[model samples]
Target: MKFFTAVAFLTASVSAFTTMTPNKVASSNAMAFSQFSQQSALMAAKQVPHGGVLVNQMTDDKDAAIAKATVEIQASERQLCDVELIMNGGFSPLTGFMDEAAYNSVVENMALEDGTIFGLPVVYDTDDESLQPGTTILLKQGDLPIATVELTDKYVPNKVLECKQCYGTSELEHPGTLMVATERGKYYMGGKVTGLNTPVRDFPCKTPAEVREELPDDKDVVAFQCRNPVHRAHYELFTRALDDPLIGEGGIVLVHPTCGPTQADDIPGTTRYKTYEVLKEETANPRVVWEYLPYSMHMAGPREAIQHMIIRKNFGCTHFIIGRDMAGSKSSITGEDYYGAYDAQDIAKANAEKLGVTPVPSLNLVFTEEEGYTTADEAKEKGLSIQKLSGTKFRKMLRGGEDIPEWFAFKSVVKVLRENI
Candidate 1:
């Protein structure tokens, strides 16, 4: 019922784009490309998926899988998200949950047992000591069976070490560290998964193969990752990235947003999905492709950035937009930043060549009353009047129903948020 409800809303919202005249659409496209004369001449070939293969564990025989399961375990929200990704090849090279060996290797080194680069370990955790090896367990979301894992190994993981190595902190103030410390179970289980069905979500995530089919084969696909709604500056950042020299000519930008569990205080995925759906219809840009990713945020800063690049690469992306302090978090108690502003960009740049995915550093663009959006450096040089809006102020305005500046946020996105929130 929720799926159908969202479909109806999307249908009505999409009519907004149809209302725009042909001339307006042409003008919009022309304005977006005014500064990129050389973009038409650049060409970037698509990169191969990580591990030279995309893993799909979905089984054709659902009844057989149900019969194979000896026990049923309800999956948590995070586990459900992970199952969707692993089943869809979004987490390729991972046929199932990581075994003890793979988990230890990933924790000690940001690589699998074969030394393949991996951002973080993916394992199924449980507190049940009664579960034994070789047991086939059915993973379910509520009453719906989604996947089954043939248990091969189980071991207690070192949570403190995982927090220190993966997130660079053992402090509970950090959301990631807190999740590992308190939310995750005591034991980690690894086994190959056979997916039976995909979860029903507000946003339908496309499979890697499905996305690749729609991508242009000869042109580069620049992936933009975000965990929040796309505001005006965010829109400008990704659209303008197509003109970056590192991106191949005639590249299309993939506005891929993670629509899964994020920080406890962040906006809900269903709400964020509505904002993106409306924005996509309103923009109607052919050069931009919109897709939702079912990835739970780790907020692991540099390591998370690498993880994003590898995942995007599996989606046939040839370049990724690495912005300032990507996936960075702060200490709740001290309000101290965990990673440097350029830490993600630096690490992404360093590993770009090896990953076969080029990293495009996001421009530090600021809003100016005189010339619209421009680099912060250029705005300073020209002495332009910069417009400022803090997150706290924006939330207050939204709650009060005050008019948000069109220059700071898209009117359509704001309307969706207001109605939903």
Candidate 2:
């Protein structure tokens, strides 16, 4: 019998896998997919991880053995995020949680053993020190059995090193740093996972395989990553990205939002999902696609930007939008930004060649009094009148029942925010 991994199905058109040699890392010039009008393109169509999409299917014979497992461990919310992405092929080429070696490699360098540019380390960390190496742990979320893992390696990690490498600082105020510094479990477990079923969620969560089917294979797809509600400027930025001359005609946008736990102050995932749903119906644009990811926001700035690119590649996106301070988070105590405004753009641009997904710098669109919406540069050059409303001001309007200008946001989106208030 022949076994086929999920990546095999995703990259069916290509027979040979392309590895990224150090020399392949070229200048960060992301071309619009349409510009590659040739008999063959440089990058492969589908981007899979180092080993391929790691899928662990349950064997018929092993079901009985799993049922008889002695130890049952409840999975934390973070671990469930890993389980959903791993099982759904979103985290392609990762079979399960990272082993100690893999974790250490990712911490020291953002690459796996074979030099795969993986951004973050995904591990099953728990404070349960008693879960021995030989134990068969049944991981469950809210009383629902999701996966079974045989603990092969259980060890403590250097938390300081992990945070410093991934987040660039170990400050307690920074959310990403805080997570690694304080929230994660002490002991990390590493092993293969036998997925039984995906945990149920209230919001719409689709796997990469499902999204690929919805996207047209021959057309250009640009992915927009967002955690906040889509304001008019944001909508303009991504939609206009497709209109760039370099981008061939008939390009569509994927409005992929991270509907998972983020900063403590950001809008709730459930609330954000409603806004996207309303906006999708209100705008009624066939060019824009909607999907939600269960990825927990690490706010690792540049590194996280690369992580988004890799995941979107597996989702069948040819291009990804890298905006100012993408995936940026702040320090709660000091109220300071963790990364520079353009750091993510620079990093993603540098790795665009190796990542396969072209990086489209997000347009800085602003509303003009006389000319609808235009890029900031265009507005300045043409001396057009521009209007602005800070997020704090918008929230005040929403709360005070003030009129939100049609130029700033969709009425439908406003309705969702107003209802929440």
lDDT by residue (193-248, candidate 2, tens digit) is 66777777769787676677677766788899999999888898988999876466
Every candidate's lDDT = 0.81, 0.73
User: Candidate 1, clashing residue pairs?
Assistant: 42-249
lDDT of 1 by residue, 1-421 (tens): 2343223222221111112111111012223223222211112226677766666677788999889889999998899988887777677677778877677677888877666777888888887888877789999988899999887777766777787889998777888877776677666777777889888788889878778877888888999999999999999999999999888788999999998898888889999999999999999999999998989998999989999998999888999999999999989999899999999999888888767889999999999999999999999999999999998899999999999999999999999989987
Model 1 per-residue lDDT at 136: 90
Q: Against the true structure, what is each candidate's TM-score? A: 0.89, 0.86
- List the candidate 2 regions with Cα displacement exceeding 4 Å: 1-62
Alpha-carbon deviation at 337 in model 2, angstroms: 1.5
TM-score of 2: 0.86
